[model samples]
Target: MTLGFTALVTAIVGEVAGTMSLRKATTGSKAWFVAVAGSYVFAFSMLSVSLAQGLPLGLAYGIWAAAGVALTAILSKVLFEEPLTPVMGAGIALIVGGVLLIQVGSAY
Candidate 1:
């Protein structure tokens, strides 16, 4: 279970990194294109490993996607000076709450 959780976390990180790289690549950075591709590969690999280690698909994917969105939004605000409005903040909170609910529901 610990290993599975760790893999899930890695998957989330990879996804966030991939998205960030995508932004940079879109701005004409060739190196970021490579990073975007590699990060996605790493993300999916970790996600698959986590599933194989016994994490439920619904639970794992929900957490992975939500964390990715939230982290990406926050990091983009920090790194790229992207605007994070109050509504967006509220949406992120809701996403986090939804993931928690899914996790608790899964335990049963």
Candidate 2:
């Protein structure tokens, strides 16, 4: 993959990690608090780098937000045994489709 794409992926992963840590941090864990803060800082830094590398901000942010939401939901189900009802599944599908649309629209 291209460097910019790799950076965007890194940013998304960091965002997901930060969001996941938010749950544990809220329970008063100092270590988790550090993780949460660090993850977010890393994520934003990478996002900025991706933008600097010529990834369009609108497309990058749309993909980042959608992928983060979808992946976080799936990870929550796997890691925390959270529910993955049909409705939620449909919503995730919609998010993925929307991201795809954004990418396609940007290409033209």
Candidate 3:
């Protein structure tokens, strides 16, 4: 895979990890704060790398944000007993669809 795509993937993973760690930190674990901070920094750094490598801002950010929201919601439901209602699932689907549209539009 291209470096830009790889960096974007890393950014998505880092953002998701950071979000998950934030939940732990808020639940009274100070150590998790470190993970949260580090993860966010890494995520943004990778995102910048992707942009520098010629990924359009709109497409890259759209995919990253949509993936982050979807992944975080699913992971939270599994790890923290968070609710994953059908309505929320539908919202996620819409977000993914929108991002896909943005990606396709960017091609033309």
Provide C-alpha RMSD values for all models, in order.
Answer: 1.1, 1.1, 0.8
TM-scores of all predicted structures: 0.94, 0.93, 0.96
Better by lDDT, candidate 3 or 1: 3
Lowest summed lDDT window (length 10), candidate 3? 99-108
lDDT scores of the candidates, listed in order:
0.94, 0.92, 0.96
Model 3 per-residue lDDT tens digits across residues 9-72: 9999999999999999999779999999999999999999999999999999999999999999
lDDT score of model 1?
0.94
The better-scoring model by lDDT among 2 and 3 is 3
- Candidate 1 local lDDT, 1-108, one digit each (tens): 499999999999999999999999998768899999999999999999999999999999999989998999999999999999999999999998998999899878
Q: After superposition, how far is residue 28 of candidate 3 from its true place, in Å?
A: 2.4
For TM-score, the strongest prediction is 3
lDDT, residue 6, model 2 = 96
Model 3 lDDT at residue 81: 93
Candidate ranking under lDDT, highest first, comes to 3, 1, 2
Candidate rank order under TM-score: 3, 1, 2
